[model samples]
Target: MRSRLFDAAGVACVLALLYLERHLAPVPILVIGTAMALCLLLRRAYPVPVAAAVYGLAVVQVAVRPAVRMVDVCVLIAMYSVVKYHRRLLWGIVAGGGAAAGVLIAALVEWRSDTGSFWTVFSVVGAVTATVWASAYSVRTRRLYIASLEEERDQLARLMAADERAAIARELHDVIAHSLSVMIVQADGAAYVVQTSPAEARQALDTIAATGRAALTDMRRVLAVLRGPSAVVEERRRPRLADLAESGLALRIEGSAGELGAAEELTVFRIVQESMTNTLRHAGAGASLLVRLERSDGTLAITATDDGPGSVAGAEGHGLIGMRERVAMHGGTFAAGPVDGGGWQVRATIPVSG
Candidate 1:
């Protein structure tokens, strides 16, 4: 509603100027105003072309019969509208606007029959040129600032998306890593007991059932996070290297646990777990996983390998991407590939600031 009122005012000013130019009282002015108003209707959609047409018409008028009356009030307004809305070639628009104003003002003053002095002409040119340039400069600065703000907002949105993906990856690790480890341990225990002790094998079966249910519950909780707030998402605990090595995973360490910060230790632990989990998933049930953590000088080297069917290729998923991101976060070198003869091997050389 307010925009319509502004356009109506512009139309009224244009009609008043046209009336004075023709000395046609009000009738001819109303006709020209209505015609120009049609251009205004589509100005937003085609600002540059509409403004160009208006300026072109004025240039023709100045060439034929230059007068104070034909100085073009509507043309200046249209040019300003083009710069404000069109948002292209700002430097060119400013230069064009300044040039047009200067030319029109000089022509009007020079051609006026009852003109005064050259100083009067210069004064008008200087004043009008200064005012138009100032207005154009202000518009250009505001547009540049708005563009910078929008770019900053886009960057912030990307950071938020990355954080959400990281949290989800952590949740998936907690669910799959512990489940695979416990299952492998139980299966090995049952196999050893099957020939020697049948009762012990039955006990291993019970452990397998319990581990499976726990894994299912972990998955359920993870999926629940996606639903509405009516559902609860429990806090999931992730399996680190220390937990597996201490537990029945039979992880072997080559060197002592060097003096390390909790954060660095956690990073090492996660790297080892992710490696072992990958082995269990792809390397088959009887895969032999060997873990080695060695610290020397100022670096920690953590490596894990499994002698199993992982000698062949399966698929690479989000797990590899997440592992790379985690290792890169703390400035570490990571390598994971197929061994020459058999199995899968992963190694990380991480810097430790003791």
Candidate 2:
């Protein structure tokens, strides 16, 4: 709506100026001025064609009448549209040709009259043409810069989303793998003693039921995080070191757990979960495992050691790789190797800033 009003105003101003200077001007001049004013209405839609028409009319006007009138302002407006809307190469060629034609016509009129300075006319027309084109080019460059910045922002958002999905995949793997290992162990024990030791077999069945329930709870929590922003899952479901005691593992927490960020806390939990799962799978039955979490001097440290046979080598398995990646993402150090006393150990230290 604002643009339509401005175009109407421009046409009115040009027509009024032409009439004020009409005195003894030819009918052709009035018709040409009106045609050029109408062309301004289509400047934004068809800038090149409108600019060509304006320049052609300008040449005719200069040839017929040597005196300048306010209608000439239309030439600047047309040229500004050409540069602002059209590509630079095409606008450059068209503008250059039109400027040359305008200058030539003006020079001819001044020479024929033999009363005005040719350089003064040339300089004035050249400066106005240069000023309008420069202004339009500046605006075009700024718009292009803003478009590039928007494109870059969109690309960054996509990368962050991909990273989030990968993290969720790792968490799901840790939860399922650990729960299934414990269930499988208990099921095997129950099958072997079902007839010979009824009481023991019944105890194994109870353990299996408890492990299944815990697995379902943890699975739901992980899935909730994947349901996007609308999900109302608890913000933090961190597992404490004392939780390991129920699984027949020694628990030791040093200093304080302190206040860790969400990502850091999740990373710590997954590392410990994966470590325990490996111990349950490869360590011998009745093995002793020690789980520890400590915070000191702006760093949080985690260690899991098992007193089982040193059979679980630190290979590039998916579980180990996921644990390493999680720790590295938080700028932490991670290591896993066989301990001196014939056992496997996994340790990591993550920096935590308040």
Candidate 3:
């Protein structure tokens, strides 16, 4: 809209200048001048074509009258618009050079009749044309630079949003998958022994209720973080090596515990939790799982091995992928596969600064 208004004002000024000099120029020159002035309306939309037409009309006007007229100044406006709107600098330079050459040649043609030196007229016209072209090129370069910066900012925002979503997914998966696996196992056991053994059945039911409550609390904490950084979040204890006892996995420690950050602790907890859950789902009854943690030489090595004849080929799911992603976040190495003899093992090594 602003370009349209600006072009309209330019055409109005050129028409007024042509009217003031109407008596000096013949009817043919006046008609050509009016046509050239009106062409500025489409200059931005069709810069190259409009520029070519305007320069072509200027040559016709010169052939009609050898001396420069007031209406001839409109060609400079066309020059500025062409360079500002066009992306190719080579084209702008070529068009600007052509127009400048035309001005110099026209001034030379009238040198004998008019009382001015051809060099003086050429110098002034060339300087004005160079200044207008330089200004237009500068504006175009700055506009492109700003556009590139905006594109880079948008790409960074998308990457950050994707990372946030992945983090949320990992947290939810670890919480829900582990809790549900435990509840399902306990519920099945309670159903099997409800009539024969009342005490064991009641104990299983109690464990399910406790596990459900803990899962709800963990989910609430995750949701609170999602709500916003400013939202009130209750502090809860992070998981540790000792927590594996609740999952019925035997634990062994080879070295003293090293100081770890909160994120590292949660990563360790989730890794073991997922491994134990996989074993429980895939291994049949009477299977045994042993988890070992060895910390030494600025590194912590974790290995979970289960002695079960069941093949883990059918147990590959998002739980295993989530564990791998969690370990990667800490710059750790993880692997899970069937053992050489007849078992499955999940192992990971995490770096520490102890």
Indicate which candidate wins on TM-score.
2
Q: What C-alpha lDDT do the candidate models reach, one value each?
A: 0.65, 0.77, 0.80
Candidate 1: which stretches are off by over 4 Å? 1-26, 33-38, 56-71, 90-106, 115-126, 152-156, 159-178, 188-198, 214-269, 275-354
Model 1 shows how many backbone clashes? Answer: 0
Which 10 residues in a row give candidate 3 its minimum summed lDDT?
248-257
lDDT of 1 by residue, 96-182 (tens): 565567455555557465564456765775566556656865886798899999999999999986886676668577557657777
TM-score for candidate 2, residues paired by index: 0.80
Q: What lDDT tens digits, residue by residue, belong to model 3 across residues 1-354?
A: 887898899899999999999888899999999999999889898888888888899898888777787888778888887788887877788778877877786668668668578888788877888888899889989988998999999999999989988888878988898888788887888898999999989988987888888788778777776787655245355667665565533444445457888887788788878877776677765567777788888788888888876367555578888888888877999998888777788899888766
Model 1 deviation from native, Cα RMSD in Å: 6.7
- Candidate 2 C-alpha error for residue 209, in Å: 5.0
- Which is the better candidate, 1 or 3, if ranked by lDDT? 3
Question: What is the alpha-carbon lDDT of model 3 when measured against the actual structure?
Answer: 0.80
Residue 275 shift from truth in candidate 3, angstroms: 0.9
- Quote model 1's TM-score: 0.58
My TM-score estimates for the predictions, one after another, are 0.58, 0.80, 0.70
Descending-lDDT candidate ranking: 3, 2, 1
